[model samples]
Target chain A: MRCRAAVAALWMLTVPALGQHQHHHMAPPVSDSLQWRMPPMDMSMPMMPGLEDALPPTQPLLPSMTTPPQARPGEVIPLADGDTLHLTAGPVTRTINGQSLTMYGYNGQYPGPMLEVQQGSTVIVQFHNHLEEPTTVHWHGLRLDSRFDGIAGISQAPVAQGEAFTYELYFPDDGLYWYHPHLREDMQQDLGLYGNIRVHPGGEPEAAPVHLEQLLILDDVLLDKHGLIPWGEEVPTHALMGRFGNVMLTNGVTDFAIDVRPGTAVRFFITNVANARSFNVTFGNLPVKVIASDISRFERQAFAESVPIAPAERYIVDVLFPETGTVAITNSIQAIDHFRGEFYPHVDTLAFVHVQGAEAVPDHRAAFGQARENATVTNDIDAYRSHFDRPPDKELELSVRVQQLPLAIMLSMEIDTLYVPPVEWNDAMPMMNWLSTGAQVTWVLRELSSGLENMDIQWSFTQGDVVKVRLFNNPRSFHPMHHPVHFHGQRFLVLEIDGVRSSNLVWKDTATVPVGSTVDFLVDMSNPGSWMAHCHISEHLQSGMMLGFTVEAQNQPR
Target chain B: MITLLPFLLGGLMMPPTPGVCVWTPEYYQIALLPTRRVPEARQAEGAAHVSFVESPFGIAVTRAGHYRYKLELRVSGLREIEGHSYVAWLATPDLKDYQRLGPMPANNVLSTEVYWNKFIVFITLETAAAPEDASWQGPVVMRGMSRSGLMHTMAGHGPYQQEPCTVYGYY
Candidate 1:
């Protein structure tokens, strides 16, 4: 215990220093000049630069002066024909890199369709199951009636092949949400039964100076020589890792290009729909002002050097193209080349910003002032900090590890039909099972009973006792799992990572836990109810890498 | 280019081992039998059908006809991606087919077993004849699908294709 304490103290000393070094290296220098002048001409615009010379310099596809259509409340817009969405689900022929192949799609599109609605409005969607087998649609992250959540057997009956189901969903809050299948999620979601849903707040006039608002749904797919790979055909063993695709796509298109005029302030609502992969996205070297998150608008605007979005997460970033010739929104995280276990050199160009037409307004400096002030302040860090700092009665240490076995031995075990290997990794093993399950390998969450039948634990705490939890990722094992740890109903203050504390930690519901690293956070369990804590990776939770604790009033439910 | 080497090589380095028949009934037969019971020596004789196909990836076993059954081409010594690594029910109109179920509820059988970066393929049929028991009819086959510009690199090498097979039962 003394040695452990000593080690902890040493970590406390070293981590902060390392964090200081990283902060210095990563954080951009703040320009003290509050003049808000247009960036120098030669400074190279951040989002899309020098795209004017790349194109044939042709006339812009859409007029630059065109304004985006505004949406208002009490609008009963018909999203689909009745409650049933007549969607065509089948293989579509498409050519990628000069090779023609068939890929599965819904409504003849890779990403089904975009469903737009107003907050507090009722959404009645009639869906037709066109696939050969039965399936259902789940509105991810939407707080709706349990029956409309679309879980086969759990919430509602599965829409049989050639059958249809109508879902009546009421959007309680205004924000970004998504939809996909809840059953055979690994297969169906990967097979392209996914779409984006945006709910605009009711009774509010649209913010002015918002030239264009674009929905960017980021998805990663593993394509075969034919086109998009089909799911459910091959049954893999590893369920923890979920599925990883080779191709990264935005709005269902690869090598996509978006044309815009210089000095245009655009709203880019980015959503990560990948099954397992997390994206670190950058719009070339441009500055981005993040306005909102998954569920609601931020108290203040935050700047992102590079936005890291995990699955089922959303970030709305406002970026003004300084002098966009052409800028590339690229995936900054390097891909993992399977063979060498090393990083791969691939720059997936997600989108292109093509600036066309002569300068709309000379001296783009005026554009900043002309832009309406955001009702919310830009740099109110305290408001962001207040969202966290909740206290919890109980604290737990969660770890993720993988178990490795020889290929021949593992195959023999399955053929012999001897013993069923444990789904999750616990105290015994460390490697995750990506190959067998076609999901990431085994990950176990310990500090609980084995059977999990009677998981009733009482966590006692006062009204203001700051609950601190130290999360550790064992480095002594192979295939350290990156858990996007999340807490339900409330947010917390991220105190430290790898023992180093960060005062600049942003408020988030999900925080990525790197391999062989440790993160600490403080939470106030003021919300008296049973809350769940687990990795955001859906596969991990499906494979039993999850746990929950209940917070009660001092003399409440025993 | 420099970082992609390991991933490319990882795909290439995976060893291709052929499948082996771990359990084959001695006297299994695919024909209509006089009685359900059979002599010990010919345990598999009255069985509707029995056939196995071997490939570099693994072996596939299938039994069809009045009673339908399908077994995946699986490798034993391997572990599953998540949960227990065993033969699961892929797709069954009825939920109560498999003896023991996994984390997911019994009714939905989209996938049976998960293997090394690949999932096992199996399906059973539900008919009035075997209302309680899941059975299948006709020919049982296993196949692989690929898409264009998509590479299936194993152990860090090329997107190699696996040979598909159709298993038959001789009465």
Candidate 2:
């Protein structure tokens, strides 16, 4: 076992680009031995100085942008079981990468304050909208009433501009959840205005073993020659691909460093909130065990060196630092430049972990085993296993195309254009990005059942119907792209990937469907409401690559 | 650059329908003009198909001079360009004047009113938010002339000044 750990460390140094090749193969088994560690190395990719940052959104900000007050991160008011928490949504001036820019925020914080509560406790949030545009907070990955689901048109009307609305949030399940604006989400969410929520179990065990915990919010911002790229209000900025950020951020800070004892166990609640970019995170010389995915625990923890998290997805992992050194957390993914049909290997450092002390913490040796003895993990196994025998109820295909016509011919065509409505803080010019928004219409999802593509109501299922759906991304497309498919208000089990039935039955709301790949999953349609299933990449969502379906009540006809 | 000129009525190969031709499940091919993206050689190789049907007096009688016909259209591989809209037109064989149909819908099927024989049926990509005019301004994408025949009925002498007399009754 020690020899295998040493070999793994040596392999990390010799074959630096192993991640690019290993993803094509099946995932490795979880290591039982906890000693496989790689030494520190230089955190720079081959193409460092010339990689272009993401361009600004289609529309630039006007000069008369609103600048609201900022909030302290530690100023969250603690609430008892049923108290009401007040939150204000407005603009705030935040400085990132030594530049100050105005962005929309909740309670004046870039990433809004953490709202913690106990399981089964119904809490009320006095959501006040103070921005120039309408906004609503969507509780991502939570099963709640449909009225508070936060979708603009489907769930409920958006909180009107300069108005107040109260949300009655009931937390039935215990896990990590998040909140963000739903209307014009590509603009509001990208420019801050996101936060996390944690629901603790009711019956807490006293004197639980002490372990270091950190909640890392992963995000990025695109900067152009004119400082922070402005958010598009009317038209999506990078419609070909999403507007990806160049500067990496963790917990709203660039230099997110942590000091810990040499041999202590640490748990990280990691969430990816970037608009388009996927964060493939790896800790130098540290092997982490993935304990939970999205909002629930896995049957058994799986150990991996690097894990890729897509937009609006969450993962909880635990790692024990054995040796004393400074290790950097790095992102190891190749971002495709859709315009030029090129790939840029973006391997950059995100944060640092410092280990100094000598002795291991005495109480945290059995932390991994103690964390899994919860009631939620035991209750979900039988419900998931019962649906493995049923065949898939439907099949769908995800497709994208890039077509080019002469510029003069495109300019001569008559198009039905939709403009951004009037806003005080936005520029008056009717926003138009002909090259990005008009050149190519890519990212389409087709349902074979109805032969309808893009925004078509594909199906209607009754509540409690266990359905298996097969999603295909074949090689016949004009260009290959990865899509993080998300289903609102439902949690599904990933049964198979590329025809390989998964041994681990982890529940996920958003699953990454890679290029030229197929994924089959089982969805227990438990929530009775109109839910949307679409790609989570913000640009693709804006370009009509989405569909909605209703889960009717059990007694009602579909 | 091979330019597709207006196909005169005499060159049509399909025989024209007699009276109130009922539309069927399938559509017959008309003109197939190549757009800027697709060249003449490629379209000739069957890259895409543009077909339509005419059902006279199928829906209603319009305020215009002719009886309203449901002009159904279908295009297999036609795509949506970002800043442009696809517009259909009905024009004379001599390229004299064209009646502007509205912008194409998302489903690629539209019901329009057309009563002219010996006319050309074509589609063009239009600029964003262009005026919904009755004239053709952009280059042609797919063009085909209608199956040629003479009109089945002439103007009737009535109180409505050479208009067809209304025979209102229950079917």
Candidate 3:
């Protein structure tokens, strides 16, 4: 009887299962997804979990309560300072790469709508939730009023089905921001419920205006043969690694091509809205100058070959086409196969540029070629330069804990070892990755001092305090992966990564911390109100990897 | 407006007052060496030479292979070649065992850090966009040494700065 108890205890605890995996370095099967084998379906849970009906379902399209609606682009509602706009959350179907899939959209549009507002203006947004579940529109990367910041419990209650709530969004920074549901983003956001907000410089004449500009929302979806892959009914699927889609999308379509005049300098404002993937991409090897980021432009303009963007982060790059031809905008990265211990280059063309015409209007190649130095951003970060060496104010560990996972996952992960690479490139173990749902996995943002995980960690700061927080992603955890840590209602600077301080300091709301890495960010607690910080990966956010903190006046209660 | 900086190839900002440059744990200036590939007319144009700061990131660990300082490299006056790039490398003074810092990004700047006290910094022009091998298979175009590794780049500040940190022209 005692021996039986010991075996059962060992089965439940993953720490004891740390045995040696056979392959030290895995060489993946080349050129074929068919060669990759699947797992046994009789494990424990089905694609659709806890459904009352015991009827065996068809091959791919599982049971779903939401139906697909006719899809379209959310009408852009350009508002002046203090203007109001109406927004709605609903279900819609988007066809990607010739395949139609069901998704939860805003205002019947896949990427809701592009809300254009003037910088330094406060706009009132009346948000109505039409989805069956609760939702909230988080004005991501914005330092708006705390009441309108949009995390359900902190800013306001979750707007339930058929309910409406109002948000007074203030755009203080002149850059590209975004809006998306703050509740169950793993499903709501992954399906669609998102949009972009472009805040133009408030009434200021352009320093260096461009002939043309474009906003590109980069996204992806997981699809199968029958229809859209089913989402977990009880908890979020792909809980361990987050959902990596087979289909990639740009501005809600696979075929995202735009026309430009030869020798034209077009400014491209790119935002990554994917659930987990970090795209290391380039624009047809064009003469690309990185101009701005999430909140502010760089102090100095730079030319680079690729743009590596993490989820929820924004980058503004201007590309110059010296001659006319077809230019393919693509995301290419050397992805590692954890199971195989080999690297594979994954390249997907995000969009295309048909530059095959004479300059219709006067192009800005000459003006764009001129060097740009934004002294404002450079001078702004100088104040924090004195505090870089200060001891960290807080240390948070980004890690995952698991319970009730099947024996196969436990054993496989044990062999895979506790130490994994800094990044997970693909859905290497699809069946096991998805099966480790929220019921069995819990990603945490634990405060090291108090040993508090997630919301239990309460941090308070003065309105003007530059709080330095060190985030260490534990490499020893099972299924270790990258986490894009994002803070709400404030702008922070990435001070350092793995102990090296930042040389080029730009204001950012989100930053990616690779596995086995240590990152320290100094949050400019200028906004006084309740705020939250969490990993921006949609599935990780839904898996309880979040915490809420309050920012009071410098003289407020200690 | 976008234009080339006033030619100051040999040194930036009056040579940072040799041996008297600002040296706090927070911010520091790097003494960049002139590269032969860059013509005398280009100045500090073709390679990285600029700010090094200890931003809000924490103190460097004392353990081996732990970084204690960072350098933000800004390169200008260069053009891009298809599938080719300027790869950054940090190596020991003996020219053995290098850490291949990946290719410079679209911004023409390499955001980098150093865990070693004495090392050689070189930027090689590689045929590929990103090279995965440990050994660089390209020709070195620009080079600088961190003999005054951490703070001695100020020319005469610490024990590291017994040697001159800056050499104006390649000749």
Candidate 4:
């Protein structure tokens, strides 16, 4: 039988056979209907008929969930040329800020471990899934074979419990990248299953003359009065704007502060791993230059006053503290009124840069020497200027809207409901888990021209076609949004904003489309495959805001 | 009758020129109509008609010698609007960054300079107090985009309605 949700079915088979774990099953069994396809990935509980209608103010707590995974510190299994490093995914407990939260990790490390490899070298990882649930490690932002894209159902099946898989990664470009579990990213990633990949250029990897090199895996953990909030058991809730972390964390540390010397340049590798929140990072009056973004260098250095780092985007910047003073690293968020009625401009200290010690020699020149020399490297905008004057081959509009009736209302009043005995709802707080069922939110995206929703193949382009695309966000949407539109297995240049030509062109796989703005890009369809272009915010993807596009290989006789 | 005759005669004298600048209903629909609208309350009170003209044919001009587009509006119930003032702005159809065209003149005929080829003429009712930025805030009263003798060098709908608007020139 052709199952619409082959992914969900494959995920179900990965559940542990232990009888004690059976009670955790909240997901409805796979059905033949098309509606059953594309079930929410983290939904483990079934809905009871009356439970939703009469949303009680409170409910009982669940028995202490399985002992939080024990800690297995990140271990470095060094790999020589043509060698493989063995990695395992399993339950682990990590204590941070005197709070021990049970979560899963790679090699028992909260952020796993950084995989360092030289450019032009190949590294293989033998991944073993030891967790009770299914999971797959997706090499985020890696330009590799589509089969190893790590997307469940589309790229490969979920790695079953006790199953082992191997990923042979070839580093063509030297930059920063990351890895995370593609299955239940909202849940797994939030708990911890993310790490960084640093691909240094070959031949001694001439290091930028910086006093200190810092790689910060920027993430957040939402906590309530009881400490770590209960995981969204049935479905990852906060479906509208995603669950914003009340406790801002960097490298899983609540109090993230770094030491630096005056007049010394510090190279910072920053990646936003939060499921949603976009951080507008700034150092108080510190002179800085953005050297690279998304692992690709900019043609020339651009002064960084404030940089908006959205989820899944990376930036490498060099900062020089002029004087000996503590410069606060703050996230200035403005114009965000999703839950709040008024636009509140807030400056939050995500981390602090305590500048101490004696002034050291600043090497700002060497920091940018490699970048400036290799400016026209692997793939840059200058190489594609020939097609700049040519007309765009395709135009696309990205739009989102809420359905007339809430999905929760429809599911509660209509559709079949599965009843769970009262005891199962308990988990520190019953109402908390129930709230995360994601019944109230039903957001949808469509290719405005075709009017087709989610996963529909909207367009096809031949390989090597220089396609210019105009992606405009619908201003009239019920809830206007800023989308970090990401294209898988492809890179493009942002040509213009609203109609004004951009002065500096940068190659990017993900571009942030502000609300009520049209961004024009020259899409170099060099990678041939069926890829996805969607909002990078985890909740948006879950709400069906993604679509498929194909790049057909040239010279193939069809 | 004497005052309205000059306005009518002025419009009739310059019978909309036929060229790349012709303003048809489709041009308005393509540029602005689908994206903006007058609120239901404003629509129920009275209808507003907005018309515009580009340079070479436009009657509006700036002191700076820039070709200013002429914008004329006949909107009722402005006198009834209290505690707030209506302001006009030029913005892209998506309503991104906008250029304030100043408050609506009591007489309603206004002229302002614009840069983009595809843009919407918007009138927003703002608080009586001064605004922080020149951009539009509060509810939109009327919205529209104009096509005139000026070159429409922006993206437009393709020959096939189903196709993406990849063509970025005058049809």
lDDT of 2 by residue, A1-558 (tens): 999988977775554433223222122224532211111112211111111222222344421345556544523445567899888888787777877767777888857888788877888889999888888988888777667888888888888878888887877666677888877677788878889887765754212334687788888876533345555446565554476676788888788899888777777878888877777777875766777777577755666656567788888787777778888887764433211112234566888889897666684656644534434554675776777767768777777654452232122111100111000011011111223541255678887777788677557888888888877754234433467888878788777655445665667788776544466768878778887888887777877778887888776432
- Which is the better candidate, 1 or 3, if ranked by TM-score? 3
**What's the lDDT for residue B53 in model 1?**
21
Off by over 4 Å in 3: A1-68, A203-207, A360-363, A417-419, A554-558, B1-171
Candidate 2 falls in which docking quality class?
Answer: incorrect
What's the alpha carbon RMSD for model 4? 16.6
* Native-to-model Cα distance after best TM-score fit, residue A353 in candidate 4, in Å: 2.3
Docking class of 3: incorrect
**Candidate that beats the other on lDDT, 2 or 3, i.e. the better one:** 3
The sequence of per-residue lDDT tens digits that candidate 4 reaches over residues A226-251 is 44554444455545456566567777
Error of 1 at A393 (Å): 3.8
Question: Candidate 4, which segments miss by more than 4 Å at Cα?
Answer: A1-64, A68-80, A203-208, A335-340, A362-374, A377-379, A389-391, A401-442, A553-558, B1-171
What candidate 1 gets wrong by more than 4 Å, as runs, is A1-104, A203-208, A227-241, A334-346, A361-391, A394-404, A407-434, A438-440, A447-478, A485-511, A516-542, A546-558, B1-171
DockQ of 4: 0.03
Rank ordering of all candidates by TM-score, starting from the highest = 3, 4, 2, 1
Report residue A552 deviation for candidate 3 (angstroms): 0.7
Flag regions of model 2 displaced more than 4 Å.
Answer: A1-66, A74-78, A202-210, A334-345, A358-360, A363-379, A401-435, A438-442, A554-558, B1-171
Per-residue CA lDDT of candidate 4, range B1-171, in tens?
A: 322322332332223232221212111121222113434324422212222222111111222112133344444444436677777777765567678877877765565556343456766778888574756667776655443211111111111122122221113
lDDT of 1 by residue, A1-558 (tens): 999988966764543222122211122224531111111121111111112112111111111112222211111224522333454444344444444444445665657677777777776777777666678887765655556767665457888878888887766556677777765556566655677778887754333345678888887665444333333233333354555666667776677677877777778888877767666667888766666666555544555455666676777777777784888887664333221122233456678888776554544445433434334322533544543444422334344333344443243222211111111111111111233342324455544323231123334445334577655544223334567666644345555554344533333455655443455666545444445566656566554455555555465331
Residue A361 of model 2: what lDDT?
Answer: 61
Query: What's the TM-score of each model vs. the native?
Result: 0.53, 0.62, 0.70, 0.64
Model 1 chain A weakest 10-residue run by lDDT: A421-430
Model 2 TM: 0.62
Interface RMSD of each candidate, angstroms, one decimal: 25.0, 28.8, 20.7, 21.9
